[model samples]
Target: MSVRRLADDQVQPAKFAFNRDFAAQAKVWVSKYPKGREQSAVIPLLMLAQEQDGWVTKTAIEHVADMLRMPYIRALEVATFYTQFQLKPIGTRAHIQVCGTTPCMLRGSEALMDVCRSKIHAEPQHLNEAGTLSWEEVECQGACVNAPMVMIFKDAYEDLTPERLAYIIDRFEAGRPQDIEPGPQIDRVFSAPAGGLTSLKEEPKPAAKTKAAAGAAAKSPAPTQAGKPKREGESETLGTSRPVTPTDQKDEANAQSKTGKAAASRSAGAKAPAAVSDPARPAARKPAAAETVASVAGPATPATAGLSDRSRPAGIDRPAAPDDLKLISGVGPKLEGTLNSLGIYTFKQVAGWKKAERDWVDGYLNFKGRIDRDDWVRQAKALAKGGPEEYFKVFGKKPR
Candidate 1:
């Protein structure tokens, strides 16, 4: 609800001549709707002005108001209702908007916000002193599959923790393309079944059509032939209904006849049992299995679902890549798996990872790999200490 309105001068007004073409475009946009429904075009018109000028100016709002035949206040209403419209000014290069919605909050959004707060040197909606970075806390931008996310310009950074998030923001600030990372930045696998299992099977569908139905629809043309009578010896008493074949449809005329109940019966007779476990077992919850094995903890610390309780908050660290995995010499992939299993998923998590915690995971995973070799705990210590260089100082060199 609280937004920092950038000073008017922060964003310059668009050149004067630009309005001529912008009005043309708005007219074109307005024409798309039914003759009298000009109001429906308010969103797109405002969007075009924002796109052209970087931020919406009062003059542009007036322009839209005039074009749509509505009062200026009405145009302003449409613009302000959506965060997409910037009223005052914003950083031209990077405008990072973090999601503080339920899902992102539930999965460490605040720690991510902490990274934003430190790196941008301002809280949400406040531009950093350098005028290159600004962030705002907004509602869901639809990346819940990879929650704890932020929107940088038009692209999304998902599955974030404070560590991975900090590096990502720094990379953008340094003029690096933030497109390097793939999948969600966190443990989620694009909305996997619990524990993220995958399955491919057919179930009875009451109303929904299937690939088979679609193919049938495409192939067959006329259900009733103009001249041919029902085939002799084909008694309706058979109780086997044939899918309607389009007699007019040359290609599908025979497709339906060939793939009847006989074919279905044959497939049903040979179908194999699926390998997925039954519901009532330990594997009952798929994502839960992977969640176990670490932190032997309890109910989440008392706070709202998206809110974390922080007397003193610790953040996670990121190694930048799998090659950095060796930094924690003892935390080879196997130990890493145990750590992840124990809910200790990232290096920053490992860095914030307490010594007692490391001992616990080391003991639990029976770590033959000596994680102490890389000093990941200390490395994480420095990450919580400050920015990028301080982060790399612990490892003795910066990541390229």
Candidate 2:
């Protein structure tokens, strides 16, 4: 860290006080901490001062010190420690901080600095001719992936070229910084591959099924074993299914009779089930006797095989232990429990959710697109494959 101080011989006003709204906000901030820890509101109070005066002035720091009942130097110590506070004056409209770290340096941040020189003062912290724009080169803003970025006030503008930076400066000088969007300047999501996703591009789409597969699916009976008798001690597996009893058969018959004419009419128009094909095979000679294993498996579900509303997802099994879903950036303990309740107990399950399923979950949880915003699918995919190592390799950082 470098030395930070107020301008020498700079005279502060005789008195300073926050406006009505800021005074209320300041009290709210001070009230957040314990009784004796009211001084902990120093940082936010300093920020409030900065926002009011557009920079941290000597008088503003003193006012904040008075508000917190701390020594004046104590407030000065904090104001100078954080680079976020501008000790001196700034451009009236905007102060741009260009990132000059390794990533931005490699991505032509020097070109941005040159643009700043031509537009604003040759030295940073000095206002332009119109006194509306100023710029300084700073360290990385943690947007290394979208290199060559600059922050104007509170918002970051990334993936900048010299020409783009020039345009941004012009807009700010013209009192119209809102004209520019604040992230990548191309058709891409934040920090994603510029050419689009490289891995995990195989999200399932509704593909047209082959004729054979479609016919096979149609011919598969919904009651292949429906009428079969359950031997002693047989049990049901599907929650909604049960063995047919005499009472059930009688009720079904009565219901059919009630709608017999409509049923006949509908049956006349319904398409016939497709035929099944078997390939020719030669008979095999029997040699050894094989022992049969008794299945401890629960009762089968044949009536609801093709009905998605009644069928469980194929090959999906509840794990003996759930994954740590809180590893995802936006997921906390409460969110992890919500996902578990939704049957998303594994990284693979979260990774496999397509847009439709994600939308459903997002709506159910009232997250409103937070999944896409945090790129949860991408994170879950990496976690599902190789845990921490894969996550680090893919994202260039560890999972949360």
The numbered model that scores best in TM-score is 2
Error of 1 at 6 (Å): 7.8
lDDT of 2 by residue, 1-400 (tens): 2356685444455556898756766777787789999999999888878877788888888889888899999999998877788887788988989888999999999899899998898987778887788887787789999998988888888989899888888888888878988888876788999979989888788978899999997876443244544443333222134576676667767777878977888789977789655468556565443322223344554342222432222234568987899988899888887677656788988898777767666666667689899999999999999998678556644587
Worst 10 residues of 2 by lDDT: 304-313
Candidate 1, number of clashes: 19
- Tens-digit per-residue lDDT, 275-306, candidate 1: 89767876644556546743466556533212
Off by over 4 Å in 1: 3-24, 178-183, 186-189, 193-400
lDDT scores in order? 0.64, 0.78
